[model samples]
Target chain A: MSELHLEISKVGIDFPTPKGPFCALQDVNLKISKGEFVSLIGHSGCGKSTVLNIVAGLYQATTGGVMLNGREVNEPGPERAVVFQNHSLLPWLTAYQNIELGVKRVFRGKKTKAEMREWIEHNLELVHMTHAMHKRPDEISGGMKQRVGIARALAMEPEILLMDEPFGALDALTRAHLQDSLMEIQTALGNTVIMITHDVDEAVLLSDRIVMMTNGPSATVGEILDVKLARPRNRLELADDPEYNGYRTAVLRFLYEKQKKVEPIAPKRAEKAAEKDSSKQVA
Target chain B: MSESTTVIPTVSSAKAASKFPTALVSKISPAKLRDIVLGTCLPILGLVFFLLFWHVGAQHIKTSLGTFPGPKEVVTQWNNLVAEQKDEYAREAAFYERQEKRNAEALKEDPNAEIKVREYNGRPTFFNKIQTSLFTVLSGFILATVIAIPMGIVIGLSQSLYRAFNPVIQIFKPVSPLAWLPLITLVVSSVYVSEDPMFSKSFIISMLTVTLCSMWPTMINTAVGVAGVSKDLINVSRVLRLDWLTHVRKIVIPSSIPMMFTGLRLSLGIAWMVLIAAEMLAQNPGLGKFVWDEFQNGSSDSLGRICVAVLTIGVIGFGLDRTLLAIQGYVNWDKSAVVR
Candidate 1:
């Protein structure tokens, strides 16, 4: 097997809050193999987005490191392209122009205007967004805008694509539709992908492997499940499948287990506190 | 998903259907008539009530000016002005004809005559006042726009300078145009230094005052607009490695235009208001000056002519606002960019 295309090592992130430090993620380590689809699933605010942003170089790791194809990640570079949850498109640009801007920037000096247009058209068509090429962000539906964002990201032909809950803001039906479209596109292109999602069903359906994070303030990798589902999964058909239930149950259990511990009012292990007090008294 | 994704292709179709709003409105079996009536009733009712009160004020309650002429009086004054305009036209024709005959003989002797013909149409017609006011308003507006937009962009782009200049702007923004008129008059008298004595002092005063008053809103709005562009868009510029000029062209200006237009609209409305007030105080030959002149003359139905001036002001103001709005809609191109 080819070496992993993107590796995140010993990563931890702390954010400043008014009251105190907020530990969003802790001791996070992962490697995404070439041509593999990896989905990081956790409860909302499990710092899944923080981890994705770190990989995208939008945010830096406090202590650990991010490496892409054996190079150290310093800041945002064209090798990693991100599609944000909100589409993050320039509201002023047409879909065609937005994609063209991405392609022209990444493939600078390699393509002419006609060639760039062809590249934009190819990716737009891949996401079935050819008709919306001339449409502005506001002129299109939320789903359509997300498709344009996806097209723009894919059009860049980056080494690893980092999606920060790309479909989290959509309706269930639109989410499912985009999931299918994403699967189709991923199969054709086969680039390394690290997607951040809170939806368990989304994780099961889209990923070769799911990296589930424990809930914060010091979140860790709770479980990593291998989804052995076959290719070209029908979203509706797979949801009803017995095997789908097995994967869903496993993720659900891990989430609920840490969710019980990770809440603010939850009782801690009584012995640990008692032991801490006794040790303090002896000291 | 029942091909909900197909909606992306027909966005323009949706937009076109949305333009009328009555069709899909009915398709949804909406209570659209109720909505239209509900939406329109208040403004319509407000207009009716306004006219009614105004009618009563002009007909019954005699102000210090004596029975402020109602809408009927206004129509009459308008017609009288129209007749006076026609009579003036005849007089102008006679003056031109007499002068042309004299010039023709002179020109027959010297074909390349450098003759400056003057027809002194004293109490030059009401139309002339409108033309004067329009020219002053247009000239001031163009000059303000030429200076304001680039300045606004520059101030808006920089954080520290924006903070530094804000205090001075705040100090001056609310100061009345009337206050600036005396100062501008003094400056222009000394510094303008043009020997064109035929150039009306009132015209220069109104223009200078309008330029000062109207330029602020555009500056403030453009700056705020540029500053308010999404951080995400800024990050995109960084990643794309676009230079400073590209960043401004592709990101900043387009995002700021709607706000800039809002400023322009506001500035224009203020400019007209200021120009009128300046004219009123200074006896500039515009609508406001016309009103002041009539008030001073106190002619029979002088107040009626004042009403005429007021009505003309409202109509002209409305026309100017709509024209700016039309230009805004034209340049925006992306219909979604409109505020409402």
Candidate 2:
């Protein structure tokens, strides 16, 4: 791998609660290379979003920090554009205007007005949202809005794209469509991306490396699986490919068996269940 | 011949039956008919019923002036006021014409005489009072909007500021224009001394009273709206690294617009109401003064004229609210979302 593009070192965060500080993440570490696509996969409430937020510079890690190209990441900047799960496009602005907003901010003095317009149009075209660029977020479909959100982040020409479940809110068909488009865009731009997802197939399909996380109160990196898939991967062909299935099975085992999630039970219920199991064993 | 007659009757009856149902159904669907009835017809019917009740009830309530003026009497008085306004306009025109003639003659004689123009000193008509009330209320409302919106935004952004100013706002919000009127009058009379005053003392007093009372709703609502901006949007701003001014202009203002407008609408309504009350209490030149003068006059026409003023006030208030609502609808970008 080339020089590390982004490094998250021993990151830990404790959120203040009524019962004192609750540790959400501990000793979380990852090093992502330039143009590498990294996926953080975990069960619900495994602090996947927390890690993403810390990297995005939205939440500061109490013990350690994130570094981008040798610079310590403290506050959010346009260079680390985030594609939020909810799309987060200002409802008042049209899709084109939403992209224009970030484009203008990042390239205010660097790019001329005509150049900026072309760049925004280009980003919208990348997401296949050229037709509905004039429409507001409320007027567009959920998937289309997500496309606009991606376009907005891409318009900034950021070094890293932080997406927190970019296609999580979309329907299955739409999700597949978006995933295809995302892979195409990532291949073209070669932008380093860190995506947090719950879908096992999504992680396996898009990620260069899948970083599975353990469950929290102190969620940390459990294992890292590097997929040596060829360029321009096809979902249909991959279904029958043994290598793809092998990778998919590996991730499934890691999620289901290695870190099998136990349903949270009340202390009294757990004690009763323990007693029942012990009594069964004696019988 | 009997078979032909019977067939003709049956065919004609069938034709009539088909025509009646189709014509009614084509003209209005059940949903549309319901909307029309509920939206337009019902309101008009309610108004007509109210008018009838008022007209009948007014007859039994005899006052010193005579039987309390009914709808007919109010209409008559309204026409009388309109005629009086027309007469006043004619008198003003004559005054200006006479002055022009005098100036022309003097200039012709002296060849270098300066034309002296004077304002017409005629008594203001009912229409003039209405104009004065509108002008004063708008001035006060506009001033309140300018001060409150920015102040509200600032207070909303800072927790300390909001906490510090909330008490002051709460205390002042519930204050009556009547209570503020005397203090405003005293302050204006003492402090606003000038040889050539731009605005009348009464106008300033009434305006100040309106401003004091009407500004609270806009301020509080703007604060609430600004504070209530979605957390996700704020994060978007942060990620963009937007400067403070840009953050406010792009995210805060746009998101809080609906609430700010809500505040503005409330403030405008309060301003209008406060202006009238202040005008009545301070004897300022407005519709409120017109109503008060009619009440004091206690002539046979007095009660009827007062009724006319009451109806005019209600109509004007309704018109102002509708105007604000229209503006809100135009500016609000979320077309799918219901405004009202």
Candidate 3:
């Protein structure tokens, strides 16, 4: 096996709100090896996406840092391509043109025009978006638009692919279809990936390891569950498989049982008040 | 899943089909008569009603200049103006012929004779005034667009530049063309010194005044548009590590196009409006000068002629706006955007 490809060590991010500084993520650490698929899953507003953005270098961490291939990540570059949740494809450009934009930037003068055309076409075909290549983003369906977004990310041939809820906006069936295609592509390319998703099944089926986060104001990693599921896992076959269900259950337990609280800070305050009374009686 | 995905491509194909002009309704379709009536008949009816109102209102009004000229009087003056234009053109042709004949005779008598073919000094007709107005306004508009677009891009790219420029832009934006005319006229005449100038001082004054008043909209709109480019697109550019020039050309300009065109359309409208006022106040040779000249003459026919000039200005302004609207449709990426 190859050595570690990405290391995010003790990253904490803070945003200034009108009230004061708001902590989005805190004390987060994770290491992803080459060709590894890691999913960061948590409830909404748990800073899972924030962690992904930090790794992608879209957001700067207030404390700690991210090291990609032994280099400190400070800014975004072509080596790390991101598939945004909204499918951020330019509305003015066609799918082919959008893909070409990244390809031209990454591989300018390195490949012949014919080779570049094949590269773009191959990527489109990878996501099965060849038929809608000529249509602009507005003219395509939400699902097709997302496929083009994925195709664009793949076309860049990044060392590590970062996706922030790539299929979060699509309908269930479309999302499932995209997930299957993603699994196939991941198997074929063996690219390192760090995806942020909330779906337990999606995390289990697509990831080698799932990194769960506790609920935020200051969210941190709660647990890391390793999925030992076999490669080429089928969505239908995994429905009844006990091993697959076991991984899903373990994640659900960590999220719902161990980390469950109605209010993030109120319970802690109540416990502090009880401790104060006990201390007064002892004195 | 296949069935659902197949369903979406049909929608795109249908949209593409509907995008054609002929797809409004086929020749074989049953609603052709309705389309024609709605398109042409209603507009004609509105014009007829307007003419009726003008004719009826003219009878009741009594101004010191004279009774207000109605549609009939205005049309008669318009016909007279057309005849005058034709007569002026005939005189110009005769002037050229006489010059040519004199030049030939001089050359025949003395092979190296210093003979010149000078332009005819004749009174400009109504049509000539229209031409002058169009030429001046378009020159000013093109000048404004050239300066405003690049300036706008620069200011939009940097927050500090925008902040530095914002106060100056806000101050100058509201200054009227009328107020600027006197200063422009003095500066133009004093600075534009030449024995044989390509353009007259008055023309320069009017053009500069129009440029000053009209440039603000385009500049402001461009700045706003460039600054308002989607954050997602900005992120994409950052991730791609595109150079500054490439980022602007590929992302900023294309995304800001719709807003930029809106500004251009507004600036053109202001330029046309400002040119007329600049011409009227500065007494440059345009439709504005014709109107002012007619007012000074104060003859019975003067009112009618002034009416004709007013109507011509309105029509030309409409035509210029329509031309820009058509251009906006052509240049804009979003074809479905309603430019009108």
Candidate 4:
């Protein structure tokens, strides 16, 4: 566990806009050991997901680069599997076929067809999605679709897993359920993972290290808080625990007090925020 | 939640709970009664109204040949046409039997005698003309699909190639089959040379004209579909490290099938229309030709026969469209797609 499994050294990404080149992220540095779970949390448009995409090799970094297991990632490969924010499973394929597509392509030389089927079932079982393996994405709910997305990513036996807001679109109870299952799956598999999220509780509950990002147009890592909570932590216990509250408070402070100045793009949102600030002062 | 209002299940459970609504509907006799009445009675009433108006209008109309044929006259002509086809078949069978008997007799009397079978040359019936028209249109449609689909895929995948061919497509798309018929006829006549041709020249002319006019819709639709593939799906393909062939096969084709089928349906419509026009103008042996001949015949029953041909053409066009829609429903993975 002491050895680094993945490194993002001073990576920067720039997208061309009509006016000029917009720098979404700059000089972002992250390092993870073999079994670490890290979360990048910030406001929307903070380039947290941009950083994850760079690490996944889906987008090329303008300056620095990502290295996985001592190899520079120049292109996306099955070894670095990604669970996209929208659960990007092909709508035409059932859940089983979607995961099997990636597994068959990546592990063709090493495993027989029957073994691959067993591996796919095993991953689905990990995400508690074995019951709905034959359902198409359209036929299932948003949470089930995201679970299948995770199953597909893990079925490849990837060296590193990248997930972008996997449960951000679900309801509160379902999100919590998925988060718990995710933690259980992570503990059993022990794969290095980097997830992007904006939720504070999700960051604290699932990550070993929460890497807080500053807001963009030039976003970078602002703080790294190490989570020392014991393994297999209970959510209900942590909700009332003083030590967990301290960790939660620290993340909230970084997001609210330290980085409270939100640049609203829409006038309606800006008006609403102003009203919210006045209400808070009144309370 | 209120007592009367049921709690909405979560999304995952929603799938398992989908059957509840249908089950509830089935249990309600009034709901089922309303469904049947609305579905069946309304369309039948509209059709009946159309026939009544058509019959009334036909009585007042007068033409150079005679009074325009009404529904009753069209039925009479249809029966006459069916009887003519049966009589023609009997004549053909008798002619073949007589030829065989004479050839056998000649061979028995003289062992070295030559035996030659001549074809029966009876006028094609209305049903035979319909068969010819159907055969010609399907062949043209299949040929267009074979060429247009591959070409559309290539052009869609390459931006530079799309730009190069876009102007040509825009220019040629509006040209009618009538405008190309003369040029195609001349070219086919000068180019296609065989001592024993497999197809008649007039048939070739009609088929080629249908192919030319109908291929555009499919090509344009396919190009648009390929270009419009969702960005998230492309990202998924990249993440899985799918090769070019696999990406196209698994992702591009399935994703674009709905749009591709839409194009094919439009092309089929155009093919059917163009084949009828080509058959009429080129004097080919089909329904269009049958109508043209009836117009020239100018007998007392000529207008009624033309009415029968027109009705048959409309019925056949509707059947073809329904067939294509059935195929689209079966092949598309999205089972919830409403074909109508």
RMSD (CA, Å), candidate 3 to true, equals 9.4
Supply the DockQ value of model 4.
0.37
Best by TM-score: 2
What DockQ do the predictions score, one after another?
Answer: 0.19, 0.46, 0.36, 0.37
Rank ordering of all candidates by DockQ, starting from the highest: 2, 4, 3, 1
Write down the lDDT that model 2 would get: 0.89
- Which residue pairs collide, candidate 4? none
Residue A192 in candidate 4 has what lDDT?
A: 89
By TM-score, rank the candidates, best first.
2, 4, 3, 1
Q: Per-prediction TM-score, please?
A: 0.81, 0.92, 0.88, 0.89
Q: Candidate 1: list runs displaced more than 4 Å.
A: A69-74, A138-141, A226-249, A258-262, A265-283, B1-72, B107-123, B146-162, B195-201, B231-243, B256-258, B281-283, B332-340
lDDT of 4 by residue, B208-276 (tens): 998999898889889878877777787788889898898888888888888889999999999999998
Best model number under lDDT: 2
lDDT of 4 by residue, A1-283 (tens): 7798898998987665444456778999988999999999987777787788778777788899999989999888889899988999999999999999999899988999899999999999999888999999999999999999999999999999999998888999999999999999899989888998889999999999999998776789999999999989889989998988998999999999887756667632433343334323221
How far does residue B302 in candidate 2 sit from its true spot (Å)?
Answer: 1.4
lDDT of 2 by residue, B136-240 (tens): 999999989999999999998876899999999999999988888888899999999999999998899999998999999999999999988887898899899
| Each model's iRMS | 8.6, 9.6, 9.6, 8.1
Off by over 4 Å in 2: A265-283, B1-27, B102-115
Model 3: residues with Cα > 4 Å off, grouped in runs: A260-283, B1-46, B97-118
User: Candidate 3, which CAPRI tier?
Assistant: acceptable
Error of 1 at B259 (Å): 3.5
lDDT per residue for candidate 3 within A161-229, as digits (tens), equals 999999999999999999999999999999899999989999999999999999876889999999999
| Native interface contacts kept by each candidate, as a fraction | 0.38, 0.89, 0.78, 0.81
